[model samples]
Target chain A: MTILFLILAVLAIVGASAAMAFRSAVHAILALALAFVSLAILYLSLDAQFVGFTQIIVYVGAVAILAVFAIMMTRSDSAHHHTEVFSKSWLTGLVLAGGVFTVLAWAVLGDKTQHAAADAPAPVTTVTQIGEALMQRYAFPLEIMGLLLTAALIGAVVLAMPLLSNKSGAKSVTKGDAR
Target chain B: MTPLNGYLLLAAFLFSIGLAGALTRRNAILVLAGIELMLNAANLNFIAFWRYGTHPEALTGTMFAIFSISIAAAEAAVGLGLILAVYRHFKTTDLDEIDSLKG
Candidate 1:
């Protein structure tokens, strides 16, 4: 199990770094997909079957497809498209991310987290228990999430509808004038 | 048999990579991808803690991860739609060039 975990973690880390380092946006996205796929495997190994499947279906399937569509739609053939990998503030970003990682590593590797982990009992978290808890114990948050999803979808449609309608309206006016 | 710290350290690395990408990338779509990575890293942390915490049978972490995944999907949809609008107005997806609102 440890060996499997190590391989998956290494694969995910490689994919993530590749995504950050790639110049082409398409290549970055492919690398990101690889990272997410390995992450789903990690979830499965961690005994999170439901979460693992959902990660593949929702993130890998839907979110990545949307990102690809967005990229294709906004593709620029200009010479500067390749240079979008970074900006002047990248050094600041590097420092900030590095600091955050250092703090997190120190905390996780500390004795407190180790003792906490050692105290935990064995678990048998299955999908049925999660389903029951979702409805019975955690119903409120689920309902709120449903509402949030609905609101976001409506907002997306509203945000995109105007430009679309304006184009169709222009076409209709020209056709009417011709008629 | 991997230690909890091992998973936590991995999560930290993933999150930092995501943070760097989100902070530095000029493409809005790539920024969104970075945010997804950050979210996934958080999900991994949650599952790790749930598996290794004192009350592993509580089902909180997995449930939280499921909710997070759903929220991430919604966020991606909305963010992409906004990016589409920005692209239509600006004719480019480069974040550096879309500075008309820089007041």
Candidate 2:
């Protein structure tokens, strides 16, 4: 079980890195989907059934599909047009990322002594326990999250209105001219 | 046997890749994908710590991951809407050519 977990972890890391490195949006999304699945597997290995299922459903099913849809909507027929738009400073990106990684590594390693006790077996965080906490203690935050989702839906409708109107308006203008 | 440090290192590597992608990507949508990767990296760390460091009483990590997933959904909706709006006006989703909004 431990070896299987280790292999999955390594695969997840490699897949995620490939997702980030791929220039093509389509390829990147595919890589991300693989990475998400690997993560779900990792969750299973950790005995986190709920988290694993949710990871598959949310990341692989919903988010990845959304990303693919976005890519399809924006892509043009000509390869030249697509390539022309993605010019950026790759070297600076690498340096900045490396610097951030080094800092995070230091922070994570700094409290090594504090984490030595953590090497022991801890109780598994089950779904029922999490549900109880959500209802009993963090109910307010959960309610707030619902409100936030409502607000986001309203915002999406408002943002989409212009495009919807423009398409219908163009049709009307053409019809009026035909008349 | 896999140690907690192994998970932490994997998380760090994933995060670094996400950082690089977010920094270098020109398309707003792709940048959003990069952000999602970074968020997942953090989520992995949360779950790892919950499994290894604390007792079952600290299920904060699991709850936080759920919340983060919902937030990611909301972000994607708004972001894609903005992308559509930008495409309508500019007739393109290229980030470099979107300078009119810039001061």
Candidate 3:
């Protein structure tokens, strides 16, 4: 089990790095999907069965597919081949990320309590318990989340909706020729 | 069982990688994907801590993960829709090219 977990973690990190490393949008999305799958496996190993499955369905089924659909919809002029990153920008990002990782590594390594925590056997979480908690203690937040999703849906429709008049049609037509 | 530090360090690396992707990438969809990665890393941390924490019976962390996924879904929908809208009006998805709003 430990070896399996380690392998999945390494694979996940590789997939995430590939997501960042790739220049093509399609390839990046593929790598992102791979990372998500590995993460779901990691979650399962940790006994987070419900969350793991949710990760698979949401990330693999919904978000990645949504991104691919968006990519297809907007690929008018071979847009996927666009220069994906700036040289200085990625260097700066790497430097910043490395610094943060060093800090986190230092803190995690220095903590003694974590060693004790790791020895305890992990408890299995049930979907019924999670459901009860959400419906009871977290009922209000759940409703708010539903409301938020509804609002976001409406907002997306509004933003992506083409104007009924000729003016918005003009914007769409002029898009290709516009300098 | 894997060491708690191992999971913690893994989560840290996942977050850092996601941060790099978000900071460096120019493509709007990739940026959103990076943000999703970061969110998932946080979720991983939540589950890990819950698994090893004193109160493993309480499903608070799992509850949070569910909520986070829902929020992320909403964010992706709105963000991609905005990307489509910008592409329609500006004729480009490259953030560098869409500079008219840089007043």
Which is the leading candidate under lDDT? 1
Ranking by TM-score: 3, 1, 2
Candidate 3's TM-score on the B chain: 0.91
Writing each residue's lDDT as its tens digit, candidate 2 over A1-179 gives: 26786788778877877777666777878888898899888877766778889989988998899878877776731233546434467679889989988988777666544442434654656678878988988899999999999999889778855524567588765665366
TM-score of each: 0.89, 0.86, 0.89
- What value does the TM-score of chain B take for model 1? 0.94
On the 0 to 100 scale, the lDDT of residue A75 in model 2 is 70
Candidate 2 displacement at residue B92 in angstroms: 1.8
Model 2 scores a TM of 0.86
Is 2 or 3 the stronger prediction by lDDT?
Answer: 3
List model 3 lDDT by residue over A1-179, tens digit each. 37888899989999999998787788889999999999999989888999999999999999999999888878722333645464346788889989989999899888866334444776866788888888899999999999999999999888777663467567765664455
User: lDDT by residue for model 2 over B1-103, one digit each (tens)?
Assistant: 2366767777887888888888877777777778888888888888877777646456777778788888988888888777876776676766767789742
Tens digit of per-residue lDDT, candidate 3, span B1-103: 3477788899899999998888877777787888999998889888878787778787877888889999999999999999998987776676667778842
**Candidates by lDDT, descending order:** 1, 3, 2
Cand. 3 Cα-lDDT: 0.84
Candidate 1 structure quality by residue, lDDT tens digits, A13-61: 9999988778887788889999999999999987788899999999889
State the local distance difference test value for candidate 1: 0.84
Q: What stretches of model 1 exceed 4 Å from their correct place?
A: A76-84, A113-122, A164-179
- Two-chain DockQ for each candidate model: 0.70, 0.55, 0.68
